[model samples]
Target: MRWFGFGFNAFGQIYVHDKLIKGECSDAVKQVKVISPTELASHVDRSDCCLKTDGQIRASWSRRASLHLGGDSCVCLGGFGAVIASESCGISMKETPGCKDAFISELYLTLAFPDRIESWDLQKKEKTPSWSMEIKTESSGPPLNLPLVPGGYIATKPPFYRPLSPQLKAKSLALSAEHAILLSASGAVYTWGLGSHGQLGHGDLTSEEQPRAVEALWGMPMSCVATGGWHSVCISDGGDLYVWGWNESGQLGLPSRGLRKAPQQQSSQQAATGDLYTWGWGDYGQLGHQTLISSDEPQLVEFFREQQMRVVDVVCGAWNTFAAVVKEEVACS
Candidate 1:
C-alpha cells in the first residue's frame, strides 16, 4: 500500500508525498476527490460517521488520512461518499453551516488497482444541481527547501538520510519561535536567532546568525532547553534550572536590571532549593522577584519553595514565562 502525506511549511512550500518509491522521484502527483457540500452534509453526520436512512452510523474510511474541507480549504471523498473538515491540509470533522453548498478544495482518493496506471479524465454528469468533474495528471519532482521565517521551522528525520556524525543526531529535530525547545541526545544545547533580551543564552545581548551552543553550558550535559521571545531557560542533568537573557519582569527570578550576557551558574544547593535563577532586565513580575531590578550576573529565585516541584518544561513568550511541573497522581485502591 502507498502512504501519502501533504502539508504547508514555514517557507510556503506545499509538501505532498507518496512513500512507496525509492530515493526521491523526479515526478510526484496527487489525486483529489470533489463533491457538493449539500450532498456531503446529507451523507455525513456531525460525528463524522456515515449515517444510514435507518439512523445506523458507520465508521468513516478517511479518518486516518489528513484532509481539509472548509474555511480556507475544503475536501471531499467522492467514491467514499463522505466529506471532511480540515485546516492546513490535515483532516478534522467540523460542522460548517455556511459551507452547505460550497466547493471542496482537495481530497485523497485511493485507486482500486495500483498495477494498472489510470489517467485522469474530466466527465460531465447529466443531473440536476449541475456540476462538472475536471481531472488532470501532472508530474512532481523532489521536495524543495523553504526559506527561514521569524517563527522558525518544523521537520522530522527523513527515513532515507542518515547523519554523518553522532552529534548531528542529538541536534534539533524541529524548532519554532514561540514555544519549541530542543535538547540533543548528547546533552549540548544550541539555540537559534531572536534573542532580543538575551534569551538565546549566549551571555551576550545579540541575536545569532545560526544555531550556537551555549558556551558556559558546555560539558555540563543539558537535560532540557526552553525558549521564550527574548529569554531562555534550561535544566541540567543534575536537576537544576538555569535562566538567562531578558529579565525586565523578574522572569529571570534575579535581582537587578542588568541583562545576563552569559549563562550563570544556578545553585543545585538542595533538591528543595528550587534551582531557579534569573539574569538580565526586570521590569514586570517576569523575573518573579519583589523589585524591578536587572542583573548581568545570575541571581536565585526561590518560587515553588514548598513544593520543590521539579520543572520539566519552561517556555517564554514576548513578555510571559511559564513552567511545567510533574504532577503526582493519587493511587486508587
Candidate 2:
C-alpha cells in the first residue's frame, strides 16, 4: 500500500507503470506499486461512509482473507450512527472495531441503534430483498443482505476509515439529500434533515429533525466537512472554507449565481484564505468555476490558486467537485 504520484496524465488519470506515457509531471514522489487481483473487495468503514470521511482501505486484500486484516475490526460507517450502503454491488463490511454492534440489512426491517455503532455496504446485491423499515437494533447481525442500496449510495466510490474517538472525536460527515453534516470531537458542526435547501447551514429554510448545532459553525475548529445536494461545507483548522446552501449550479463558488433567499451568509471562519472552496451546484463545472454557474457563498478555486497550489483535499459530488492539490512550488535545488 505504498503508492505515490505526481500530476497531469493526459487521460491515464496519472498512471505510469513502466512509463510508456504517463504524460505530465513525475517531477517527484513516484512509487506506485501494483499487484492486482482482488476477489470480492468492497468495504467502507466510514471513509465518510465511502465518499467523505477519514481514510483506511490501503490494501483490503481478501478474495477470501488470509493475510491482510487490520483487526480492531473497522468502525466509522455513516457517522453519528446507522449505515448500510449498497446501490447494487461491491460490498465488504465486517469490522466491528469498537463495539455496539448489530447492523443486519438486506431487505430492510432491522435497524436498532441506541449507541456503540459502526457499519458499511453500498452497491450490488439486490435480488429480492424488499420490505423497508428503520429503527430496530437490540443485538442482531445474522440475517443480512443489503450491501449497497438502501441509503448508502454508490455511483462510484471507494475508501473509508473513521471512528477512533479519543473523546467524542468524529471530525467530519456530510450526507445530503434531506440533510446531514456532523463534525464532532470539538470542532462542532451538526445538522439535521430537510432544510428546504439551505442545506441546514441554519440560516433558514427550516427543518431540524434532530442533530442540530451549526450555530454559525460555533467556535470554528472544523477540520473538514462536505455535503452538496443543497450545500454545506467546512474546513477551518486554519484552512478556512465555509460555504452555505443551494446555489442552483455555480455550486457555491459564489459571487452569487442566483438563488439567494437571504439567510445563510455569515463568513469569517478566519485565517488561511485559499486552498479549496466550492458551492451548491455548477451545472457541469461542478463549482470548479470553469462556468456552468451555481453558487451561494464560499468561493475560491483559482485552479489551485493560480498554481502556487495548496488545496490539501476536498470532495463533493452531487454535481461534481474534487480537489487534492499540493505543490506550493516545492523545490530544493
Candidate 3:
C-alpha cells in the first residue's frame, strides 16, 4: 500500500497531496461535528465521521485520515497545528459558533481512500478528544493514497477493528499484540489472548476477556513488566523478579511438571537480592534451570547466580526470554 504523510510545516500552510490547497479559508466555510460527551461510552461507529461544532472537541478517522483537536482551539491530525493563512496555503483563526469564546485555530481534512473523506478540529488543553474516528475502509486491494493538509498525504488501508472490551473504560488504554509488552499505570501486570501452556499470567488454563491484575504481587511495587505468548515476567522496584503462566520448558525456573495457574514467589535460593529467577516449563533449558522439567512455581536457576547479575529488564518471546542483566563487580580490599 502507498502511504503519505502530511501536516503543517514551520510555515503554516494547508498542503494537500504535497501541494498547497486552502489559504485562509473563512470560518463559515468549514463545518465540524461534535459528539455528545455521553457517546464516549459507546463504541465509535464509522457513521459518526463529522464534527458538528467548531471549538468543541471532536474526532474522526478513516483509512486515509485521522483528526484530533489542537491546543490552540484548532484541529490537526498527522501533523502539527496553529497554521497561519498565507498565499501558499495557510490556516487562520476566526470567531465561529463552534468556538465562539475561542478563535478557531485550524481545521484538518484527510482523504485516505478514493471514497473516504474525514475531517475534525483541534481545541486547546484537551488531552482526550470528545470524539473518536471510526475507520470503515475495507477492500482486498492495496490501500489508497489520500491527500492531507499542510505537506503530505497518506496511503490508506482497510480498517482493522478489535472489539472493545466491556470491562475496559471508555478512556484510552494500550493492548498487547503478538509479542509486545504493556505496562499499566498501576504496577499490576496482566496478559491474555494466548496461553498455549499458561503464558497468560492469569494462573488458570483459560484465556482472559480483559486484563486481570496479577494477585500474587499485589502489594509489591512493580517497576516494569513483560509478556510472551505463553509466559510472563515482572520486575519489582526492589529489583526482584517474579514469573508465572507457562512452564512447560522449565521457563518458570521451577522443578515441577505442569503449568502454574498463579504467580508464585521464587525460592530464596533461586532469587538472591538481585539475581534473576525463572520458572515454568523447561524443555530446552530455556528456563535456565539446567533441567527439562515443568515447574508449577518459581525456582532459582543456579547458572544465573554465578554471574552475580542484576537484571534491568526482561522480555518474553514466543518461547524465549530475553533478559538484560548488569553484571555487578565485587569490591576487594
Which runs of model 1 end up more than 4 angstroms from their true locations? 1-91, 94-167, 171-181, 256-333
Write down the lDDT of every candidate, Cα atoms only: 0.36, 0.43, 0.37
> Which ten-residue region of model 3 has the weakest summed lDDT?
32-41
Error of 1 at 221 (Å): 0.4
lDDT of 2 by residue, 136-194 (tens): 43253332111212223211122222222234334445555457677776888887778
lDDT of 1 by residue, 1-333 (tens): 111111111110112123211223343322221110011223233433222221211011222222232332222222222222222232222322222122111222111111111111112221221222222222443221111111222121112122223343343332334222446668887766666666777777676665677788889987766554456778888999887765664556665444455675666655432344544444433344444554555555554343444444333322223333443333689
Candidate 1 global TM-score: 0.36
The top-ranked prediction according to TM-score is 1
RMSD score of candidate 2 (Å): 18.9
Global fold similarity of model 3 (TM-score)? 0.34
Ranking by lDDT: 2, 3, 1
The alpha-carbon lDDT assigned to residue 166 of candidate 1 equals 39
